[model samples]
Target: MKRPSRRRLIAATGAAAASFSLAGCSSDSGNGDGTPTGTSEPTTDGTATQEPTTDDGTDTGGSGEPVGADQLARWVPVSDAFEFDVRAASYYDADLTALAEHESDFYTGTYGRVAQSLLGAELVDIVPPESREHVVQIVPAFTIVLRTSMSAGELATAVTDAGLSETGTQGDATIFEGAVNSTQSTVAVVEGVVVQSFGSNAQNAVETVLAARSGETARLLSNNGEVRTTVDAIGESELLVVAERPEDASSNDPSLDGAIALGYGWQFDADTSNITIGVTYTEGETAEPSALASYLTEQDAFSDYGNVGSSVEGRTVFVTGDIATNQFDLLSAGTPGESSSATDAPQVQIAFEFEDGTMTVSHDGGDSITASNLSLVVGDSPAGSQFADQYEEVTAGDSVSVDVSNVESGTNVLVLWSDGRNSQMLAQAQVP
Candidate 1:
């Protein structure tokens, strides 16, 4: 198969946790740069860019607005050699094996979309870890809550404990020292807003990250934690929302000393589900216990990991199996050239239907559709097709449907379901 093009990479990168709209609900600040970089390159120059999707591990695809030199400097990881930025609650390598049951395909799958959306740019998830431990953990973005300084190792330890995913670790890893480190850190920026307890040293760490900017200039500092952590901040008016998760942690709230991480709560009903998260801050302080929960209760926000489905020809598609995660991620899906399966298979599939939009795999696979991830139907990319599937144009207000019957038994085929006639994508399926 052909290597994924840079534009496609942008979308894949941005899917992790870059849902810009939900971020706005929390109330912090900044104008959005409409740079369309995903599969559907903003055909209309800069004017027609849609909101960025959230799974390819990216936010929105597009060239971000030019940042200032100092701001750009802060973008670098704070370490002597940049490493992933790890905060108090993020998980580190050593702690990974312990948090396996707590993983969220939502974060992983969303990141995939993110990478695709932000194609061409050096991408980073502000996390660390090659693979994730399966544990129900929240993204550390809302909890890095850093206000102090720390070393690479120190941040690493802290991040491992904060989030159970790599994004948290990536942010902490930014503590590497030297040239190569700077270059890598420059690829992406992951900042934290900490609310440490009396014992957590988070205050110092947050300060360190923010302090990286010396009077608006980026600075690298070796903190008491023994590693150099770069510093930067998006100013106070910045409001960032943690990824929307299910309401499992509702009655369970966790806290730590010096600093504390928030647990999100998502509730599912017979036909619908919503979420409510607890923040670190409780009453007055920014990072206090039950802070997010209290805030969520007050605002009455909603969190739903929507249905997972794909589209082909010009209709929507659905993928089911032991299909716990990506609908399009069939183990045997391939591009134009490849005819064999590799260890890392493309199990996810894409389908367009009901409306003009895209549906991506949020989880690797789930026992059922109600527990997967997807975006509200946005516009469709006429050129969009699963791996090497064909695309057929859809007219506005058209009713379409997609469903996956089965993968070719022996070949591990990815049967793409569609409603269009005369398409080649279906022709490629290894049908029984």
Candidate 2:
């Protein structure tokens, strides 16, 4: 397999998170320049003021609890040294483990694949369950910080076992440089955290994280007050993502142009799911929150989950809503790329039969769909008018007959499945 570039790395990870519609999501390594002394051409202009001191075991190591999402800002390179277009973070709350069991194929199969790709099979396996993860990007260079339970010694052994050679040690972190599963990687193994960087700019990316943690470089949180305020408001979540609207953003969406920064958080409470999305607008450019909230309610793809509401305070517009836990598939199925085995649209094989002036629609195969979600139309009549009663679930071999005695031959017949927000044609044919 060919080596995947840093840009593609972000794409794969973003797809896994199903982030396309969450907040205006974009991924690009900034103007590629400023290559520090390294193995390959660097694609980012991020610089670090200090290199980690040679290993001294005396310093307390990663033995403490994994870094929390609240402190992630400290690990981000200062804005002066790094010019990045986007940055986001993810945290897998312990409760997500239970939710994953309910949707194993999507949670484990789809999301786990992305994690394994970035962290290597060995390290991914050793990572503690429900470990939180963070990613900071500097255009073509990106750094991944993972909170793992493995000790520094245990992590070092895993890194070397995964085909990396010990290059040096930075304080309590052990640095390894090599190819893991065909991708050039620079990985650091400390007590409870493992910072990994990939692609051509791996070395500098890893070094940047170490520098930020050591306070050699100013952290993004300390330098950017707006981001800090937004982050503080959002706090911790199962999935927390934040991005600053770059001065040179190329997007043409009028609603997004005024955005100064966006903060999104997703959480689940047993049978209910809640999402909070906030957008900080520039001075005097804030859009009407009520109108935006109305638009979201009418266009919510997961409307079956619950209602969407909004509130505006100062420059920020907050959109909040809850979804039924059973409707979680709507989120997972939206994930793009081959890594996702499930689809947002229902996959059903339907067959239509005309006999004795009556039409029969049969579900031949494919995934089961809710009966209320299916709408049948005959000769332009209103949807579901012909059905006397609807089944709770429609699966293979299920069939419904509609009286078409008054309909003319060749009239159009259609079956559509909708989840309030979106719809798809399951089968269409002309009545005989």
Each candidate: RMSD: 21.5, 18.3
Q: Which stretches of candidate 2 lie over 4 Å from their true place?
A: 1-70, 83-123, 126-140, 250-253, 298-305, 329-432
The numbered model that scores best in TM-score is 2
Q: What TM-score, computed on C-alpha atoms, does each candidate reach?
A: 0.20, 0.55
Q: What digit string (tens of lDDT, one per residue) describes model 1 on residues 1-432?
A: 011111111112121222221111111110111111111000112231122233322221222222222222222222221122222211100112221122343223423322212211111133333332111111122112221233334444454443322233232223321111111111112332222111122233333333333222122111111111100111111111221111121222222111122212222222232322222222233333234223222221111123422111111111111222322121112221232211122222222222222222122221121111112211111112232222132222222232223221211111221111100111011112
Report the lDDT tens digits of candidate 2 across residue range 1-432.
Answer: 001111111122221111111000111111111110001010111242222221321121221122333244456654344332123322111222333444443333434433332333344554644553433332223355655545678777766776789999876678999864444678887656777765555676677667667665555554454555555555545544554554443332444446666655566555666766666777898768775555445432423335677788777777777765544433322322422232455666677788998788888888888887776755323334433265788888988888888876644455655454333444545555
Worst window of 10 by summed lDDT in candidate 2: 33-42
The TM-score between candidate 2 and the true structure equals 0.55
Task: Give the residue spans of candidate 1 off by over 4 A.
Answer: 1-432
Query: Candidate 1 at residue 417, lDDT?
Result: 19
* lDDT (C-alpha, whole model) for all candidates: 0.21, 0.48
